[model samples]
Target: MWNIMKYVCAEGIVYRGLCGHRYADKRRSVRLWVGGPFTHQIHAVHNSVPFSQTHVVTSPPWRVLFFGTDSFAEESLKHLFASSCCRQKAGSAVVKLLEVVTLPKDLPVRRFALQNQLRVHDWPNVNVQDRFDVGVVVSFGCLLREDLICQFPYGILNIHPSLLPRWRGPAPVFHTVLHGDSVSGVTVMQIRPKRFDVGPILNQCIYPVPENATAEELGETLATMGAKLLIDTLQNLPECVANRREQPSNGVTSAPKISTSMSWIVWEEHTCDQIDRLFRAIGSRIPLRTLWMGEPIKLLDFVGKFHTSLSGAEAETPGTVRYDRESDSLLVSCKDGRVAFRAVMLKKRLSALDFYNGYLHPFFLKKLPRQQKKCVFGSYKTKESDTPLGREAAHKVQNV
Candidate 1:
């Protein structure tokens, strides 16, 4: 008797259901359960055996637990529910067909953290002595204890957003984008009771990061790839579980958690390549904040290309504002070269053109008191200035 269960915690409520197997032709997913309204609907359509009706000699064939935060977890549950449609659709429908679960604006990160605990590892009386088939962890921020890991005879598989053996810590995407890695991909590792992303790589999906990929952009892309990778790895779990491997104790790089201080644009210490990576890594989602001319300016969008235009004596000082105007790009100098920026954010407002225009005057004259060259494309300033440059920049935006 196999009863596949899907568990999810949302809005202080817990949703659990039996997984359905009819979705796949391979029968690899003996049963797939998704914990949400959409999953419930899919269960109905797929005719999944009701948990009450089954008289099983043994436990369910497979039970998958999705450990995620409020919106992140709930949305993933909806995605699992929607995965039934993936077999029928061509190309990667996995990316486009996710069910959006919106959370309130005031939702605290603390509450979100609690929700994940309740949904994934908070099974009241579950005994680890009785082993389960497999456990797949995707984007769930907490560490799994040995008790939970032992319960899954098949072992726990985690979808980390970096190539294993590298960036094996909390913030892989940020490090990858900030450091400018030509290749970025996901690694499915066997989870062990350890500090952070230290585990044996069982499977992996590799991809390249574009020159202009930002952290937010790369994160979303990696998240989607992670979802698919989880499914693929889970389908092959029987084999992956059979061959257990431990992570190499040596040659491990730590990707420590991020802080606001770490994210602030440090124009002086970074290099041209580092700044280029930062511009791409910060992406549109998480606007990279920097103190520009004593006022905080959040970069909304930007472009980096080889520059031959500004090659003179001023190249000695990188991060110097070489050109700032209504033009689509603002050029800045670096130790070796320069880069141009376009999209930007002023205060909390997100607009590329407005941000450029607002800082154009001060940037041109190097009148920004707080401005200091950290690298080619980075300058620091705090958010306190009466300069009408922001207002004028806001008013001067011509096209989107």
Candidate 2:
């Protein structure tokens, strides 16, 4: 009887009685579930068919319009194009990359599409004459309007860097690393209008953020993970069609676009940990600028710590740089703690020692002044008239 009911359900009668009214109420979703709110059970049951019946694709390949303009999105497209499921076979709803909606011609994504012989249409100049099954957007650089999103059978799908409802906007990768999060991941979700990333998540994949991993490294790692996850989710698209749940209400956070202001390391204002994170998050994205020997220098790498040597004492002038012969690193002062500038760039990239020897040492004395309660930044006070370093020392004194 169970086998008979399963066949009856497969024939579609069981759901008509149980879900017909609900399906009518939600016109957006074509397939209504058998178990109502518990969507995955029956669908996953069918999707678990024997490998011998692999040819049996329950639905035809969805007509997918890809919208993206970056390497991250390109990675997802590569998987989508190369997957065996995307081959020209007789499976129902197997994905077909009908066309791409990308930025102008010179961009990497557009060039990739053209090289692959895929049709490229500018976003606002969307070719809507032919209907589309679904739209997949990944870092497309702009939001789609409601009418544009509504044209597809299903609305847009976004491949986001961080898990949705957390890190819910652009530059999620930066914020995740900035906050020193232990774990971060990618989310493929419905792209809603007015707000970005506020949609039902189709799937998610998580990976750990190892200590000291830069934002660029983490983003690339997540992009690869996201691509594989998106492919698997698409392969099981039929099961996932009606299975999405709304984003959880709690634990929401925004990852706004990275700004130039975020690139500055405010040693006097920020703790060592915070300044270290700032450099790590935006180091690759933008140059971290700071005063080295009172001359503006771009920071390449930094190391932060509680400064156990200054256990009972405190950092006197936060931006003051000190020489640590033990590590061959340039230690700088931060509020409550200390940090090291491992690498920096002025006209060219160089290690802290190289910068110190060529520029900083030439300007200031070899030894920083000895102190008792707090680390003192005293050097290059030639006379009553102040040089650049002297002026900086004077400013530090006033701040203290």
Candidate 3:
């Protein structure tokens, strides 16, 4: 999904194409969550709208409008129009707002076309005079035909969240979360016909995703970031029009549109680091795996990057339980060495100290000789006649 990048406290014209993502080559195989993956485009447009009281008429800041489906995008535009923030303080100065007209039902191939890209014949409310000074398209799911591009005095600019040419698809943020990339950014570019995310760059910004972000969270966060970038560029449109800088050709990577199959978690072929990245990038949309007893558990969160050599135990394998249930930390074995879990997810909820205490089985207790009390979490007070097992799991850890 595209997020609009903007400059606060600046004047400019910005157009919004609240379009959804439609597959260029394989429509039958693609699927996505509505208002996600590609829905951030709408969010970028909605949030970046100037909340000032400027009179937006002829020769005003810059004229902007939206075109989209009758469903989500159209309704979203209506909500924006109704917002008090968009209205000027003086009732006399109305911003040049336009009602979203639905796509035409009369045109051939109307059903297959993106709601915004249907032939004008397909637009029931097509007015030949519906022209604009500039266009900013965030999550338009349809391909913009040449006629639409020619309608604007300035070309249409799009907000793509990935650093263009890589992850150039409908779900860059989703893929970034799933893949666990350390950095993901937003891009603003010219909307070239038929080419997806290959336009000349206007501007781009990248941000870091920590090891715990889920897909839903990353998508919303990126949308907010991207929208700001778009608005900032719009404020400086005069400079951009005077001097259009061509995008560099070197680091291009395409994020192809994703599907439900792409969302499935692969337990094998995934390193702990790889798995960690995917979970953070995808966010909560993709669940993490854990087993309680014999049933699989959906983990809300867990700690990774464990060190086996730190355990000081030659006999313990990676993921092996140095389970200290009393302290709420589990020493699980990793591929290379042993790592400890101070916290874990049992269902959707995260367990602090008591969670680990509840899972303590007697067999898990027999594995350690009771000397591994590193104070993971909880009360530091020790009983006078403490056994080896009690000592190991009784130390206190600061809850972070």
Candidate 4:
């Protein structure tokens, strides 16, 4: 839905269109028309003022320039394009003109703009001559300079996936899940030059994080919510700008980008819950890693904590691996509890059954009788100074 504010004359003359249509009478009262997807006719009335001698006035549609790159940014661009199309069909569009700015690569937003036949401008190479009413940036990566920001009448608006003053960086969604935040949300804020996610907030909405939600799931939810919120913000752009407030100083935090080094799992140092959270946060992009028999292995299909018992489980220390025939899983002990995985990968991926038959069964048969410690998984040494022992070097391990 979109709103068009109009000034009403004392003679009850209504300004019929969005493009500054005016009557000769003096301005006295205002009428706000709430419009549907394809219709501009008034469906509801709000903030009605008493009519007197008033000149009729109207706000023109906006010329928007949007900047984006990833799937998260594509959602907002789609909404803006749809709204522009709807308004155009109704003879008065909320967005008068819409163009896109993206990197040269075939990113999500760039592909979308090309498919829709929207004018596309490559980043740092924009050639727009006419001034735009407003600019929008979402997951664009680059820090916009002050000279570029001065091109828009209303500056730029950003649709961020996290509430400002918290997780204020590129990997907010990842950190939110990694840190096990129970609540998360989206923020629509004005953009500032030479920095990121530090502008005054125009709008914000809270969304409750579902239990055991992965970063991908949380990101998908926030993307849709942010898109809808972006449209709503544009609908009330003037009022939003007038009423915008600076973000609170308190509760500030930073969310740095995810790194490959974070994927390594240290069985002796991390709890079951910590490892589970790490998998949910970044396992989709980077598999959870561990060292097996001094060789790197990737853990897959994480099945959370294991509850069933093995006959000699209590005797085995953390990083000791056991195959559960009943569940067809590989169970590894952590600092607090055990976690299960359905498959593991060294050179090629293998199911738990295959790994046990090919690698573990023979080794365990040879080592279990003698109660040798070499059969257990060990932490990979990431630094030159790190010791080869699993427990001693666990804290210093990095991605293998």
Candidate 5:
């Protein structure tokens, strides 16, 4: 007489035995039956089951709520929107629903969300009753409270433009360029309440900073790179969350928001490279400023270091100014080297040629002896000396 028995394996496979004796499979994934000495036959019937007949497990699509404000954030939103549309069409959606939350002011993310017809929720007043699987924050300025963060199943993921523990504030890209860092990258992390960018890292990709890359150029590159990374993180959300690690405490740094006072050119303290980096970092938003004959002048169109034709006298004085006719740029001597600018603005904007003829020429011709006939910048000081001029200056600066 034969006795029949069944056993289930960890891989969800079932095994049946005629002799009631269990044997381990070679791979250890399942158990097989071995006939006893008195048994007539032994069989392994379910070993070659077709994949179509077996049950397959798959992760469901995610419902995502995104928070963003600027152009940098816009890139990630675009990628997520595209990915959702493509996946839905393929009938295996990665993101089932997408929505955005932004501040009241007109921002890039808000504009893109409106233009694309995606749902937009005004920030601090967002409704979380729709039951989102995850939340994404990119360049979003508002702080999320603990109660709000608990609404999402996967918590919130932030696409920070810098490697964390370093540059933990509102201006990572600007600080990266300003400090002349050789390498920078984007990081995907889980957001924690009451802090910014102090979250566990999910993924990171290093990018070598291009030669003399301006903050604007670097920002654009990182923005695109970050968008792709964000999608990749979402694709394997569970795995990323499982393997996430905390940021190290050794390299902690802060990237404070750029201010107008940071644009001042102190000839005695800064070098050509330092000034060049400064201009690349924030010159587009706030022109480099300096005092000329007790009046404010804004430097524009930085043309980099003047490598050739340096006189001993000009090199001796840090604030000495000279016009390079060959390059058609106004060269200003810094602590160790000379930097060139294509234009300046005092009462009005003027080209290098116009500035040389109007302000520099008359000053050199009349102010000092021929041996000391040099036009200098930052020679005078006022309480608001470092401030940039004009009504169109940044609101932050204007208020200050």
Candidate 6:
């Protein structure tokens, strides 16, 4: 049995339309679906909105309202535009892209959308008209109001980075890397008003995290996967929405956004596996910051392997910086292990040993008159919260 969809007007009015013949608007034509893959234009209620131009026959593809302000959104939009639903059998555009609602500060997404001749809107509360059939949002920062979304017959769809109820929030991709999750996936689901990511799921696809894939690498993979998943779901929007399944709220987890304060690595606190995973999360930006010789040191690159005899440092001694001149590599101490590193951000992507000896050691080491035994490299702190980032600290949301 086909499911009946309802729509509410701007004036808090509720109305329902039958499956066959209806008038969309007096000024335009309404295309109503009689059965599978068949449609006809007829005069119906003035409230009904036309999906396509009335003069031409056949059901026009959905008029999609895109909400995204990042690369992820760009990928999905590209797929939709290149897909058959967006294009007609004759090579003409079947679906129309309404204005894109994006973040004010996101220039790249806006630029891409405008380049395709699509209108872009940046205000938080986008003034949504009733003409759109469906709204598609991916990586959009703001929350859409329920009143605005109610105007459409087909509800809004959101493409999320992680599986629902597992990593739900703004930073699923980041958390997936930080936590060393072997499995990562994309979720295409309906958006619940005000809530972050709790909604009924329409489709999902999972993939393994590569051996040492950074957050950016994993995100790139998911971006492509999610784009395809979203387009496929949209192609069968009616059935998918009718068969939608709610996300299990029992295992709900929040992947709060990342912050600078969460980048401090506590050398003694985290184990070798944890430290290596964090380096992967760093990807190509926001290298971990920690104190060395009472001065700040930035960790640019880290290797997955642990070094014991290579560093000549005893096991369990964390925060010891060692330089292997032969290999041109650097080792930083971690709990029960030493993690190999390549560079520090202050200098070029060269050996950290060079950075320490040439500049950091000369200026920073002299300040410490006495070389204390069992000294932790990251012990210096300007404030108490500067402490190393732990599992709890990593996920902790500050001032949201």
Minimal lDDT window, size 10, model 4: 16-25
Cα lDDT of model 1 by residue, 54-119, tens digit = 221122224454444433234335445444344336543322222111222333322543443323
Candidate 3 structure quality by residue, lDDT tens digits, 118-144:
232333343434454565566656677
lDDT by residue (tens digit), candidate 5, 160-264: 999888888999999999999999999999888888898778899899999789999999999999999998988898667656777888999999999877887
Q: For candidate 4, write residues 1-400 as lDDT tens digits.
A: 1122344545667543221222222345454432322233423344444443222223446788999999999999988988895435765456778999999998999999999999999888985454477789999999987756755545689999888889999999999999999989999988887778988888999998998999999999999999999888888886776567778899999999998778877777889889999999999999998877666788999999998765776666778887889899999988877899999998899999998987788654675545444456765545645535554345434333
Ranking of candidates on lDDT, top first: 4, 5, 6, 2, 1, 3
Single out the weakest 10-residue window by summed lDDT for candidate 2: 1-10
Runs with alpha carbons beyond 4 Å of true place in candidate 5: 1-60, 85-88, 313-315, 362-364, 367-374, 379-400
lDDT values, one for every candidate: 0.52, 0.65, 0.48, 0.77, 0.77, 0.67
- TM-scores for all candidates: the values are 0.58, 0.72, 0.53, 0.80, 0.79, 0.77
Question: lDDT for model 5, on a 0 to 1 scale?
Answer: 0.77
- Flag clash pairs in model 4: 26-54, 26-55, 27-54, 27-55, 28-54
Q: What is the lDDT of residue 81 in candidate 2?
A: 67
Clashes of 2: 7
Candidate 1 off by > 4 Å: 1-61, 70-132, 266-269, 283-286, 289-296, 305-308, 311-316, 322-329, 343-400
Q: Kindly report which residue stretches of model 2 are placed more than 4 angstroms away from their true locations once superposed.
A: 1-60, 84-93, 292-295, 303-315, 346-400
Per-residue lDDT tens digits of candidate 6, residues 18-93? Answer: 2222324433333334222233233334544545322221233667788888887889877767653435565344
Q: How many residue pairs clash in each candidate?
A: 24, 7, 55, 5, 0, 4
Instruction: Give the lowest summed-lDDT range of ten residues in model 1.
Output: 94-103
Cα lDDT tens digits for candidate 2, 322-347 = 66667777777767677776777766
Best by lDDT: 4
Give residue 328's lDDT in candidate 3 (0 to 100).
50
